[model samples]
Target: MSEPLLSADAWTDRLFSDGWVKPSGGVIAVQEPATETVLTQVGRADRSDVARAAASAKAAQPAWAALTADARQAILLRAADLLVEHAPDLAPWIMRESGSVAAKAAVELEHAAGFVRQAGAMATEAAGLVLPSSPGKTSIARRVPLGVVAVISPFNFPLVLSIRAVAPALATGNAVVLKPDPRTPISGGFLIARVFEAAGLPAGLLHVLPGDAEAGDALCRDPNIAMVAFTGSTGAGRKVGEVAGAHLKKVALELGGKNPLIILDDADPDVAASNAAWGAWLHQGQVCMTAGRLLVQRGIHDAVVERLAAKAGHLPVGDPMRGDVALGPLISRGQLDRVHAIVSDTVADGARLVAGGTHKGLCYAPTVLTGVAPGMRAFEEEIFGPIAAVTVFDDLDEAARLANDGPYGLSAGIISGSVGRAMTLGAKLEVGHLHINDQTVDAGPHSPFGGMKASGNGTRISGPANLDEFTTWRWETVKAAATAYPF
Candidate 1:
């Protein structure tokens, strides 16, 4: 067993700018969603703080970018090592702050570390290309870092989400201002700062400010910030894109998802049911890539639904810190109400509640809904809760239609014994990520992760995508230069 990250008497109360500093926007009470207890109070950033942070990042970026790639890589690799070393403490902190079960918390920590390491390796990758040019001496295109970037991450998987953008941005030679959701600031914001600080990253290269909408808006509108990387609800992402775009700043929006898990007739019903349950209930279905709808071929729909309901009914739900539970509480009372409202509305709209549609405090039980149709809320909306909305489809065409019907195209999965058939069906779906014989809720540190249509702006994060997201291209024409001018 590992000790908790923050002791009762010692709490993180400051935000990180050039160094740890008290914020001007007062403080936000960080609560344990499972128990509704105030775990700590963290400093909140207002517009003024955003300006200062942005200015600091802008000022530091040039010097940081000027460093050798090996130097930058060394720093990022150290940060990755630090995350692994601190995982015992950090995992428990994530479990408490984000309402993640122990397994999920551990997985998030692992993913975070992997992302940082991958980003570090990216530093040494080819940063430019030789271009074919008109009869000049030489021509080249080089990737240069954006001056300063604003990274806005959500609460559900805060550590992974925040680091996915921050690590890559830093590795690509950009400074970052991180705005983590206030709910899990410790895990989302301060933890990254601590890791980097321990890794000996220079001051002002990174800033972690836990703030509200105003602070985020300020970051988007701030003249000093060159780009914005956002991961959150579609509505919030749209706003960030709009504001950032109006300022002519580059933006990467990894938004919401109404992902689908399609179970074909050939798939084993019990196995498919188990996969669906894991995809829908992991981290209480708070993940953006969670299977929002389970579209089953009519042949196996009944059997799959039955097994899924049984699993949902038996899976444990409780405070993660207090018990070994399969599913933990939703982030807050408001989120719980929203999830319940969708469930109740879907049930009223003729969807059958097969099992588990109740709550104890903030902990909502794993719910299974059957007879869910296309128009029902359960089938269409991204219900960020532990509810499996099962809908029956007649054939491959119908399955494809149902899976592609939603506005979001973040992720989709097809479970079929025939890999060829699953791959064929997967190719037809309008999704950014498609998995054959697997669940929708999956991501890798080295994969290009993003969405399509309303889910995002088609900009990806991680792997090679980071080069495009965090940097811009500068085309340089050289040698015998004066003879090249035509104008």
Candidate 2:
């Protein structure tokens, strides 16, 4: 038989700690969703692999933390440069493994590199605080790494999500045991190891273990792993949180969202439609902050819905390797099926399908739904696909209520000509990230990115905020005068 274009032989035996080595777990084939072709095979880690990785991370933590912050900063900056330099080689793998278009692949790589640089800058920005003390006594409080962190990232935007957590954990002087979703192991797992190693990171500092749920559970339950940083669905996050809580481990979660985008009466329908398309269809709407629900003012509801339907019809859904294709195949057949089922159910429940909804294989067309109301599955649940469900609001009060009614509070957006009006409405919506005259898909390397309530565990995971997730505070006090004890 002819060899596969991307072979398992290249990654099946790979494990990085102290350097690239072999893992004990066997391998599983990774398929390309666009063609259902075997793109490659990746090593499958088990509990023993997780234990070994955790041990390696724990062993390296002390020395890695002992290095001066400036030294660590330099290393991370170098890794950032290396990420950009190697992006071209890595982008194709990302495209094949995750079914990302060329443009989307490039964006993910760029954002990942920017994340590393931001984390590098954070290395020197803040350390701790000094407090005033009583006479003959000094008090100092500082942040320190939480020994080892276990990072479990999802398949969507695999490289960026994984690296964002990994970079910040490393920047804060903590070692990481990363468990990338098994489906995108090469780009999500082994590639991270190569980049950091090329940047001269020490051995045993970062371990990449590509595995399934069992591996993730083992990582979460490991006593040596001081904390867990995860980005995935709320369902999976809840299970992870349960494990972490049972073991009393620190955990940070970036979970699902059923976000909203509101259009004011005075807003331009064309502008709102443009923003809606960008926010709802980017990355095939697989993003946690995708604007799945749109609240349009009654005055412009029909016009905005028509414009969005036209936009959806025009988006190209084809092979991700093609330059003209805007929407690509989903990451797996399961996700494609789930999205299609939701769209079907919503339509059966009286929601109007204004535009595309069917799929050919894993490629689903950009979909738009109208006449969706409260108490309906389409309006209440998260559709992690290129589907935008629209509802009309009579006034600002109703719009704010509809926006805040959902269980998710990850992100929301408003488009209004008046800045004051937008601000007022934005204040009333309960969300972690709010955008004015924009869409809910906005994110930046230095931005504090996360959600509130079920969307997250009260932790933000970008810029300096991420440091809090990976480290703990220690207070020290010294007394120059000997004190007499009651004992």
Candidate 3:
């Protein structure tokens, strides 16, 4: 089926009877990898738009905060049900709008559904504990919503990533100002907003403002915005941190990752090879936790490399909407150029392209590289494309040590049959999440997802940890004893 094309005179943030307009339009716009149709524009937003959104958020937040968690949960659950009902509507847009393969888009929707359910359940149940400070002193701490939160999500994994922030923020009573990536806005925010509106959400609690940087900055730096949650690249994350810090607002930023995947000598060839292929190639390797580096023990390096290359070689790089392409285009041509530059520089630095370091338009084949060094561009940079670099190591200790060598410590994978080896390596590896015998990004709704070091700020997705990100703790020490105080 062909994607629904926008009307001739579409503009940014234009509201319609059905849904809001996507700013990206016409020829000079981001396109779907499958059919190469204009999905949205990469337009800019100014300070005024930000201020208006912020004002709206500030206005609507109190009513949202006044509602019980159970009430909020009910709304969220209704939204979840709506999402399931509209999966048919959503699936196409996700694929056509985000350049995501149908299968990957389905997985993303499933992740969104799971996260919504988890968040709904957590909305009312998410609470802080009362700690026993001293003998007679009551140290009871209660969790309170931060009033207003700003969520800025990227184009890749738009539905899932945006929801991961929105669910928790809404669940915790913070009215949200969401700025979805202009490149692929697609009703990711509108859907949530519609659900909230249907659930009798207060006027200003769930504002969806999808635009470019100036607008995003306004929301982040707004005085009324008590918290800011952003997920993007390292460069943008830093800017968000700066603005958020200047505002004295709490912020959680999940930035870039140049992840590593380690394969031990004892790992199964079939499992390790398949896992590594998907981990590196899925979503065209645009994942923040994509295995940019694959380190294999020297004893098994040759076998692992051969298997990995063969697997990557066999993987399809077809149209994303076909549900066949194991790979798709990078988010943009700019991103493709960056990946290309990295591959070129690595090749110049003596890395051998074992297979598929090539491209056609925005699409690139799943590539495998050998002879990568710590100092090379591919090793140092976040190659957010279907290019996996394999380097052989002599020992497990050496692999662990080398895995921790990079600046970005988002996530890492270990392929080993030895439980002890996997455990040891998992512990020692300097990353936020570690996987054993798995070659995929974190499957998280129950697990916390974030990175260590420069990979992220003090924020996470999923599990109990996510709800706490958009809130602050307020101590309410009631006198159950009816006494003055303890000294």
Candidate 4:
């Protein structure tokens, strides 16, 4: 069978250019998750480069903001059209950089491309409300772009998280400076820059700098940036949030999650089992909002585990670029170690390996563990990999209590016979978003996405709610005829 991926020659000749010069510290090679091969090398950014990029964005932002919102909307609409055509190629880049599967990467790219169109259409909804007052008195409030915005994207789903900031910032007419994961720069910042340029966005408005943590620290602390959006670990998110607070700027912190999947005794075992397994294994369970802990009613835990095990076994584990691949490898050796350590620690602490927790090179098996105790790190920490933990509980109240035990509140799912109980459970959970009878991570573009508690700040990216995140409101109270300040 011919492997489906760009050849080394083709990658060098077509996928990228000499623009991304390698850094001295490391070449920042893009790795193929399925094959464990180096795809390409990209440059790294330091404080100097990041600051320069941010300054450039600040300089270009005014002109971009001056451009009519309709003009920006046209660019977004065009980007969406271009994305549908380029999914095949773009998907591979994401796979190489982010360790996302080709099929899943296509979803992220397509969503990213359409994000502009969707967000642009939301321009009409950007209108501010009018306050009620005297007759002939009118108050008009409008959303204005915050100048230069810094975006820091993590290794897991690098392109999607980066674009989460880029699409909105550009669509809303704010210039963006993107700081992608240092380990996976070529496929992220560089590729995204190319895509936007191909879509006809102004050059200076969008700049890419692949850099280390120091570069990120510089970006967050920059006074020129009016806003910042970050996606990664909860500890990292807190650090960025602290810097943002220091600057007194708007920051969107999309952090970690220890999301739970609750299966009621009366819920359909087959459906719950299938959904829980899929949720745990999708993208090899690297997603921040992945449902890592499975809490099933004792009445159905055994059945659910059996079915979930079968489902996990059936998922094809292979290279991400291949169409049939259901899961890919972790982003790097460090990630692999972290994932393995967590699973091992939990087992040592008395958890039983139910289905997975085995690794073959970069490919970690879709793991399912049971009999997890509260003392285990896996029980408290974010799994961030394809290891599912099944913990049995007797009742709905107890299930909810255990689900909300973690400091993270990114997302959670509930499967139950009663819609009322499901809704009630959703509210009781501390998560920013709850998935009822489904995966914790949402796929569609229309959904308002964010986390709550330690999982996130008041930041939503693409929905009607998200429109407000990228903009600052300005209210003008002009007289019906003419109003003047009384001196």
- Return the top candidate by lDDT: 1
lDDT of 4 at 393: 95
Q: Can you tell me which runs of candidate 2 are displaced by over 4 Å?
A: 1-10, 480-486
lDDT of 4 by residue, 282-396 (tens): 8888888788788889999999999988877778776666556788888777788999999999989888887777777788889888898677887888877898888999877
Q: Report the alpha-carbon TM-score of model 3 versus the true structure.
A: 0.90
In model 3, what is the error at residue 374, expressed in angstroms?
Answer: 1.2
TM-scores for every predicted model: 0.97, 0.96, 0.90, 0.91
- Candidate 1 — which residues are off by over 4 angstroms? 1-12, 134-136, 480-487
Q: Per-residue lDDT for 351-438 in model 1, tens only?
A: 8999999999999999999999988999888999998999999888888889999799999999999999998898889999999999
Question: What TM-score, to 2 decimals, does candidate 4 have?
Answer: 0.91
lDDT of the candidates, in the order given: 0.91, 0.87, 0.77, 0.76
lDDT of 2 by residue, 101-156 (tens): 99989999899999999999988877788889988898989898899999999888
Flag the better candidate by TM-score, 2 or 4. Answer: 2
On lDDT, the stronger of 2 and 3 is 2
Model 4 clash pairs are 34-319, 356-367, 356-368
What local lDDT does model 1 show for residue 300? 92
The TM-score leader among the candidates is 1
- In angstroms, how far off is 222's CA in candidate 2? 0.6
* Clash numbers, per candidate: 0, 2, 2, 3
